[model samples]
Target: MITTTGLTKVYQSRDREVTALDGVDLHVREGEVYGVIGQSGAGKSSLIRCVNLLERPTSGTVTVAGQDLTALAGRGRRAGAELRRARTRIGMVFQHFNLLDSRTVLDNVELPLEILGVSGQARTRKAKELLDLVGLAEKAKSYPGQLSGGQKQRVGIARALAGDPQVLLSDEATSALDPETTRSILQLLRDLNQQLGLTVLLITHEMDVVKTVCDSAALMQRGRIVESGTVGELLATPGSELAHELFPVGGTASGPDRTVVDVTFHGESASRPVISQLSRTYNIDISILGAAMDTVGGKQIGRMRIELPGRFEENVVPIGFLREQGLQAEVVDGDPAPKTPAGAPAATAGPAGTTAVPEQTAPPVKEAAK
Candidate 1:
């Protein structure tokens, strides 16, 4: 488990101070894969570095497995002996496989154990076991240059696990790999999490990574966590920016009188023919404008934008019907509606709603590691 409270990291540039983390309070539960997603310069790199005290936080506390690392003595860049020993319990996997060119695969994994004064035979035995765990046992004699990108990352993972850490911090570990390799690496992380009961806190810009393996996730923007929760909770929340980003559905009202609403489906509701039921039950035609479906945390989730043949006021009961069925339905485009009926979910206004979905943009380039 990991928890950070009021965590702030400020960099002293030549001219002005750069605030990388702005009072971020994050919690990653034990034995769960948590993901932090954001574009470049969103403090993702800084956050992970702070977790291991690799980049000391300008202020606030960093707690891992009930230990307050920031409370340990040792000032300056170098950590104290106490902090150093504590770090051995927290493993870190980097985006770039920071392996020595000259060291063989087994040697790279054994580096941490050697630093810990592990005996030669013991180190080799532990390293080989780790190599086998990461499916790289046969590459023990191969050098860093001899392995593929995925294999090199596996070496990095094995090296991180040499100390048998309880927590794993991944700093964009799959960013540099191709899609296939990225999927494989992500699957490996999931496997490790399940097999070792490792508490994984990974930061990535790719939503696909979060969708595939994360039990919970946080969205970072401008150095702050804008949204965070269990994947299912986020999808079921009304007006959740992270939910919209995770399953984006685009559409506009077809005509002036028509009302457009966005519906989120997950859990039992995802498999039901709710749309067809809505159409037949109300005897009203429904036009689907846009839809997206995907599996998240081993469960199906989907979102859809649909149009109804009336103003928001006329469709209040119909919208309420959706909420009663355990679906998150909100008016995304429609004329202003009256006060929602008692016990009925409120309908948000049209494009003029409080939160308008932003246009999709290309993924930003990965930021330089801080």
Candidate 2:
């Protein structure tokens, strides 16, 4: 329900101009969790801010829920009444739970409704409902200072929902929480997306966050969108950086007689016995170097690094065999047919199709999958 065209944002200084977003085009479908990921300087924060006009774009458009936010926000830095009204339909969650310490959990949730001129009784009732929805009803009477980090975030989520927003923007909301808490918060967001039909736009530097919750994702680099697609589409793509980061493979050089091949599994292929079938068909033993299996968007997705008892050229037929079974297979490392005079096979690194194991250790595929 969100779309941007030529969304460019530039910062001006005395000497130079810096562009946080350059000709960025984005589309987030309704009721889906779409993640925008990048490093510290990737302009992810700027993009999220611009979505709600928190950071006005130097040029371009921002449209949400069939309203062109750029047009609603006239030429000034101050927000007009129209823009303010439009913003009420959008909710935002921050990395640091920005709760008023003096206010109780219930009041924190009620703040948004209060701003909307909701009556005291109605706001309290609505706040309680939101708290219950977020599993924080019991903490309604407690102050923010008394709650744990996760609880505070839960309060933040409850407050964001106070306005009954159709769209939710999460700005590193779980970055400050621990891993377990992060998972819980993400699950909560997922549940909200499904139950309330809330369309979520997530900004995160963590790949795991995207892997766990995002239905689709886009990678930002140097103020530009380098890649964007569904999780399975990206995983099946050849040399997809997003997919490689999603399932990192440690590459280790094997003995001269073996060739390393990476096999990518998506959807139904993930359930098939392709590895064993390849061995039986080709009459070659396969060694599992590493594997990473993950469930995203209710689909099984994963990658595996395997070693064949021959050079890469010799195993071409087997790699092709994997492709016929709806799997992506690529040569990770190995030599041509002829071995070097020193009896050492020349190392060849191809595009990544699976997570590579570290050179120092061969972490078993099962453990790696976990």
Candidate 3:
């Protein structure tokens, strides 16, 4: 539904030129949620603004629903009409609630329709329906100052949809709220996306937000997309920095008798009992250090750390077996020895010495598919 080719945006200060975007190419398929994540000054906000020509790009082209936005540079009434029509199809929700204190909840929701010239009866019906959809039907008469943060944001969502837009752009919408509120808003967004068939372009710095709702996410660094894919694929690529940020590994206290390794599971392989098999096949005592198992996009996947025996040398064979089964296993630098223990210390060493591994992080590599 949305496509950008070599999209570039630059800003000129009094003394210097700042390139907010540098020849970035991106495509978002219809009816899918695409997530863009990056550190500060990564052009995430600039990209979202450029999608609707809110911030005109320095060069390149943007096409949405087959309309060339860059070419709509007309003047007077004609340009205004064309841009209005385009914007009506593209909705945006800001991080700040952006509601008027003087307006009631229903009034805030109805403002967009008022701007599009939607009349009295039609606007009232649509506004009530949207408020109901967002579960704020009773708040229609209340002003923005009276509502909670989540409620105010719901009003924003309802207002964005007042035009019945095909594409919805979210700009760090949950950055201001607490964790519980953030989860609630994320669930609301997922529900709306599925129910309305709206294509969403969500921009956020939080990895949990992406993990909770996005089908595919791209990591932006310094005005460019460094990595992009399904979350599972990214996680399985050994030491993917994007995946690491999404699901971080806990610390592993190294001992004299154990080794640490990081393992990734995805697709059909993610469902198998490979961890148990490692011990059963090699007769190596394996102790699970730390593991995180979750279903992303309804698919089961896992990232785990297992400890091997300190005497475990020559991991080429066991690691090879994991690869043969279509799993990603990386031997990290650590010893599973207990604190101040030689042989059979209070640490117990868990199982066999063949595997003593803690789950500390490893260098990131692009995970290969199952």
Candidate 4:
């Protein structure tokens, strides 16, 4: 469990001060893979470091395992024996697999135990078990210089688990590896989260990485959490900046005469016969422009971009029918409605750079019940 209230980090030079984090708040439940995602300089790394007090916050409070991090901000170097004991349960893995070139794989894994004052026989046994756990049992005798990128990271993971941490911090752990290797490492992290019940904080810039492993994710911009929710929930959010970043729907626009609507469906409605209903009820020719399907937290989910023939004015009935089916539909293109809905502005341009027909304003809604 980790909680941060208005967590902030500021850095200073002679000329000026820059705020990396500004009143950020985070709440991670036990045994969940909570992800923090953003582009470079979004304060993602700074937030992760502040978790275990690796980076001292300029303001705000951080509480982990009941220890107040803000109270110990300036005392990181002198966090004392009790603080050190607490930190032993929080393991951190870096982007660069920080393995000593001179040390053997087994020795690298043994480093954390050594720092913890773990003795000879028990340390060796624990180190060997961890190496085996990471699928590098034979690599124990090999030095860090001999392993590939993936092997090196496996060693780093093994070392992080040396203290049997209750929480694991992965700071762009797969950024240095290729796609295939990244998949394997993420799979390993997911497996460990489930099997060992270890709470994991996965920080990355790649939406695919978060999509592959994170159950819930937060989008950070300007050191603040702009969006936070389950991956499916975020994906279903209409006009959400985070959703667009995760699933970029930009592509060639349809002919000027056509009408485009981005239909988002999740849960029971995802597999329902809504697409057919549109054709049967309205009897309009429809063409699917693009579609993507994925499982979020082991639930089947799918979203499709569909286009209707003729003009937006003629497609009004079909769009309303989709809404009744528990789907989110937006008029992505074509002429504005004859009249704008009360309190709703005229539609703007969509990713395809085509005119988006304005719609009657509707409040946000949750996913359909199971």
**Candidate of highest TM-score:** 1
> Worst lDDT window (10 residues) for model 1?
361-370
Top-lDDT structure, candidate number: 1
Separately for all candidates shown, the number of backbone clashes (residues 3 or more apart, or on different chains) is 0, 4, 24, 0
Can you write out model 4's per-residue Cα lDDT over 322-369, one digit (the tens) per residue? 766777676664444333445445665444433344444322222111
How far out, in Å, is residue 25 in model 2? Answer: 0.8
- Cα lDDT tens digits for candidate 3, 1-370: 8888999999998999999999888888888888999999999999999999999889988888888887775567898779879989999999998999998999999999999899999999999999999999999999999999999999999999999999999999999988999989988889999999999999999988888899888889889887887776777655566876776565463575556767778888888888787676666777777888777787777778777765335444465567777777665554442233233212112222212222223222222211
The TM-score measured for candidate 1 stands at 0.91
Model 3, position 349: C-alpha lDDT score: 27
What ranges in model 4 sit over 4 Å off?
Answer: 75-79, 251-258, 309-316, 333-370
Question: Which pairs clash in model 1?
Answer: none
Candidate 4 TM-score to native: 0.86
The lDDT of each candidate is: 0.87, 0.85, 0.80, 0.80
| Order of the predicted models by TM-score, top scorer first | 1, 2, 4, 3
Residue 318's lDDT in candidate 4: 63
Model 2 lDDT per residue over 1-370, tens place: 9999999999997899999999999999999999999999999999999999999999999999999999977756555778988998899999999999999999999998988999999999999999999998899999999999999999999998888899999999999999999999999999999999999999999999998999999999999999998888888776688888898776655788777767789989999898998787667778899999988777888988888887655655566567777887656644433332243344333353332221122234344334
> Which portions of model 1 show Cα errors greater than 4 Å?
73-79, 334-370
lDDT measured at residue 103 in model 1 versus the true structure, 0 to 100: 91
lDDT at residue 332 of model 3 (Cα atoms): 59
